[model samples]
Target: MLTWAVRMRRTRQFAWLYATTWRVAIPGMIAFPRKPIGITAHGREVVVPSGLLKLLMKVVLGRATQVFAVSRYTRDVMRDRKVISPQTGVVNWNGLSGDAANWHIRSTSSDDNTQLFTICRLVPRKNVRGAIEAIALLRRQNRLGNCRYIIAGRGEDETALRNLVAQHNLEDVIQLVGYRTDEEVTAYFQSTDVFVHPQIVLKDGADFEGFGLVVAEAMSYGIPVIAGRDGGTADFVQNGQNGILVDGHAIPEIADAIEQLVQSPKRRNQLGSSGRHWVSENLSWSKHAKKILVGLSSA
Candidate 1:
């Protein structure tokens, strides 16, 4: 509606359309001028065979001056779908909010308890259940000691997840703390030893993790992370460098990744420090905005 109003009144004064998803891009393409730039976060949405949406994307993407994708993975998908000309598509990674990145930096402790954290909606695609399962595997192996798993956020699969926790008898180890305030989330980052976002693409390939921003947020806080290799996370996590990337669906890999960090505080601190630098250099909001301006200039 707002875009339509802008079109009706400000025809001469065009605006850039930053599409958080393809759904938003659809209307933006229709209501905005072709000269203005467009941004999209994921590729699946553009490639989907929705009758009207596909047609709209094909029209706008083919003619747009340029389109920005949040990750190289997304850029590849757009090319594969022929949504945008390969030369016109650019990969501009998503940036971290200033408040989120600098809220609380974790202090290294040699003898402190390890806190495994993941803050995301309780959804199947998020693979929170996989995290829980990995923790359970650790418990069974007697490898987890003084380690607490914190899974925050609420969604439709909460009850089923709670059931999984109960089944594993991880009630004592896993805390399904539903939803948290911004302050609470910051506190978790500060106190957490390792952050894990084990996300996976669903069987039908309909849903998958996009740019794993929370992993970057955790990295910004100087916390080591274990993430999935499915999406844009690969763009940031340099596997065993800044953070560890694993196959989210593989239980052993997730458990092993956590164990590697937990058993060696020295390794954890090393990765955490490197991750902080990476976030500051590449994922900062200020840097992201500047990059967008540069992209616009070139366009």
Candidate 2:
């Protein structure tokens, strides 16, 4: 906003705005993209069709002084929607707040049971169903040894996910433990062996995971991540290097990746160690901030 920018200026602080969604980003240059469906207009909430949303994006981001997206895929989407030009837009990857090892302070699951986990809103775009199907498939085939999959988070799909789990008789294999506190999530990460979240983009491209902070958080704990081959997740998860990337829609592939990790602890350790190193080297709050400052100086 004019006052927001002025306030920062009066305080001699950088006035740049950080945006993860288009709705907020557009107003921020004014205040601050998740489709922005059912938004209020003229004091009445209404759904915004794809065409008009595109036009609004063009008009709104056009006025922005500068825009820093969370990932390269995000910047590309903004460019494709004509929201921001190559000159106005840039990608600044997310980073961890502090040291990696400093995060794992909880004692949990000292047993040999490999705990597979994922924490995200229970949404279709998150592909939690796909993960469930994969777990069910693995259980049916007796591929998973003593491992159990834990989905932590609350969402609209909670009921449906629970139904699917029951349908597969995987009640013992997969447990959907709804919404958890930040501390609880960290404790889950401490006990987690491999993090699986092969998320996807909707066909309309209206909904998708912008960036998977949970994936980075898992990596920080030296846990290997299994994410979708598409979306911003690919920006950080390199296949077979630090983490495994799979087709989110393919349940077989997801099962195969999970089975690979379960069967071979060596592979799991390799990926987890490399993932932690990558997070330490590439992802940090300091690095994220510096990228913005350096880019803003040049812009």
Candidate 3:
């Protein structure tokens, strides 16, 4: 039955394409493919049809050019699927540009108040609930006072997150400053004490933290991060030295790390400084773009 359904769907797709040849086929055929092109495969796990479509696309599109995967995990997946050969090069994930110098330097001591910031779409896989829970735990123990958490992003889960905040009565402490412009995001990074990314793998085999660009961005601003153990995040965050890596779903561990950073200004400064240095030394977009150009030129 499933086989028949699949065949029927494929037939319908082909029929539609055949019927709309003037509208779809001519334009698709006329477009010239470019080399060193940026192919982003975001959330390739959820949609089987989209994955199949992408696979078919690579069969034709990859013939004359090389491919680059955004994350190491995606690169491995592409390799397993034989989309790109072992000879093809993959670039590690890096963020798009923002105000580079906004948070690169430490401000005066007066601006050092402990504030935790997370910038992500309010989705389940982002583990925003864990961050909120950690804040609640800190507050309950009286370990967190004058500490603020600013979450900047919006999604379908916004209502649920708002409910969780209200249930915990963290309305004042946890502020959901929905969708910020690039400037606003930079401002948050510049002013915040720490950046937290509580990402986690969800059920149905969906994984999160695929080389989180926000974590890297926060690091660029010299903000220490507390990230979950998943995906390619480890490629950037070195636990306990530059940032903290919390074990799976352990709210206590995350809360403890936040509390530790909150109390020790010196440690926070060290971590923040180290993070900035690491980003500068390792993860510049200029370097990645140049490497990509080199690969494409050679290919």
Winning candidate number (lDDT): 1
lDDT of 3 by residue, 83-109 (tens): 566665365456546445544553434
Candidate 1 lDDT over 145-208, as tens digits, reads 6788888999998999999999999888889899899988888888899999988877465466
The 10-residue segment with the lowest total lDDT in model 2: 37-46
RMSD of each: 2.6, 5.9, 8.8
**Candidate 2 lDDT tens digits, 70-185:** 77776676556455566656667888887765766324458888889989989888899999899888887888788889999989999999999999998887898898998888
Which predicted model would earn the best TM-score?
Answer: 1
User: Model 2 reaches what TM-score against the true structure?
Assistant: 0.84
Q: Is candidate 2 or candidate 3 better by TM-score?
A: 2
lDDT value, residue 288 of candidate 2: 75
lDDT of 2: 0.75
Per-prediction TM-score, please?
A: 0.89, 0.84, 0.77
How far in Å is the alpha carbon of 46 misplaced in model 2? Answer: 18
Provide the lowest-lDDT 10-residue window in model 3. 15-24
What TM-score does candidate 1 reach? 0.89
